[model samples]
Target: MIENNRIKYSLAGFFMGVAELIPGISGATVAVIFKIYPNLMTILSKLRIKHLSFSLSSLSKKFQFDLLLPLIFSMIAAIILCSKAINFLLNNYEENFLTFLGCLMIILSLQIINFFKGILHQKKLFIFIFLGTSIGFILGQLDVESENISIFYLILSGVLAFSFFLIPGISGSSMLVVLGIYSPIIGAIANFNFDILIPFALGCLISLLLLPRLILSIYSSYEQSLLYLFSGLIASSGLLLL
Candidate 1:
C-alpha cells in the first residue's frame, strides 16, 4: 500500500517537475489538475525543519512519507535532468515557444476570469488590474543582461519567482527567464554550482512559508478581486513575452 502511494506521488512529482522545467508551464496548474493542490500547499506552507523531531513525526503520521518523500525526490531528480533539455529548446525555438506560451497564458487568464462572477463589484478592482499589469509589464521590459549576479540578487529572484509559482497560472521558470537569471541559473545547475542554488533554494523555502498562507487568506476573503488581479498579471506576462 505504501509502495503504491509512493508511486502515485512520484508520478505526480514528475509531472509537476516537468511543468516547472518548461517556460510558461505552471507547476501549480499541474498540481491543481492532479487534485493535490490544497494539501501540497498546506504541507509546504506549514513546514518547519527546525523542529525536526516533531515535524518529521507529524509529517509521517499525517502526510505520510509515501505521499511526500517520493514526490520531493522525484521533483529534484526531474529538474536536474530536464534543465538542459529545456534550455536547448528555449535557445532553438524561442519564437515558436513564445507564441505558444502567449496563447496558453491568455487561455489561463480566461479560466481565472470564469472563476469569479461579480469581479466588477470588488472594491478597487481597477487599481488591482492596473497594478498587476504594470508590474508584469515592467518585469517584461527589464533585462538583467549580465550573469555576474550577486548572491543577494539570486535570493531575491528566487523569492519573487517562486512566490509567483504558487499562483495557478504563473510559471516560476518563466519568471526567472523574465528576470534574466534563467540562463545563468540553468548553467549553474548544469555545472553543479552549490553557490548559486543554495541561496535561491533558501529564498524559495522562505517564500513557500509565507506566500501560501497569504494566498489562502486572500482567496478565502476576496476570491473575485484576487482572481481579477492575477488574470491581468498572467495575461500581461504572456502577451509581453510575445
Candidate 2:
C-alpha cells in the first residue's frame, strides 16, 4: 500500500516536473488531474520553519516526507532528463503543443464555470473572475526590454515565477515573459549562469518561505471563488495560446 502511494506521488511529480519547465503549462493542473492537488496543497501549507524540529523523528513526523521525497526526486529527475526535449518542443512545435493544452484548459475552465452558475450573477464574484482573466491576458500581452536587466528585476522575476507556480492555472514562465526575462532565465538554466540566476533563485526561495501560508489562508476561506477566478485565468491563457 505504501509503495503504491509512493508510485502515485512519483508519477504526479514527474508530470508536474515536465509541466513546471514549460512556459504555458501549469504544474497545478497536472496535480489536479492526478488527484493529488489537495494533498499537495495541504502538505505545502503545513510546511513552515516553525514546524521543523531539531530532532529527526519529530521533523519526520511533522511532514509527509514519504510523499514528498519520491515526488521531489522524480520531479528533479524529470527536469534534468526532459529539459532539452521540452525546449525542443517549445521551439519547434509550440503552436500544436499549446493547441492541445489550450483545448484542455478550455474544457476545464468551462467545467469550473458551469459549477458556479451563481457566480455569473454576482457582481463581486464576476469581478474576481474578470480580474483573473485580465491578469492572464494583460501579462501575456506584455513586452519589455531584457537587455541590461537589473538584479532587482531578476529577483522580482523569480518571486513572480514561484508565486504563480503556487497559484493554479498560471505558469511562472508566462510571468517571466511579462518581464522580458524569459530568455535570460532559460539561458541561465542552460549555462548555469549564477550571476543571472542567483537573484532569481533567491526570489524563489523567499516565495517558497512566504507564499504557502498566505495561499493556504486565502484558499481556506475562498476555495470555490479562487477556483472560479483561476478558471478564468486559465481560459484566458488558453485563448492566448489558441
Encode model 2's per-residue lDDT on 89-114: one tens digit a residue: 87999889889878878787767657
- Can you give the TM-score per candidate against the true fold? 0.73, 0.86
Q: Against the true structure, candidate 2 has what lDDT?
A: 0.82
Error of 1 at 212 (Å): 2.9
**Candidate 2 at residue 96, lDDT?**
92
Which stretches of candidate 2 lie above 4 Å from their native place?
1-4, 111-127
> What is the lDDT for 13 in model 1?
88
Candidate 1: worst 10 consecutive residues by lDDT? 114-123
For every model in order, what is the number of clashing pairs?
A: 0, 0
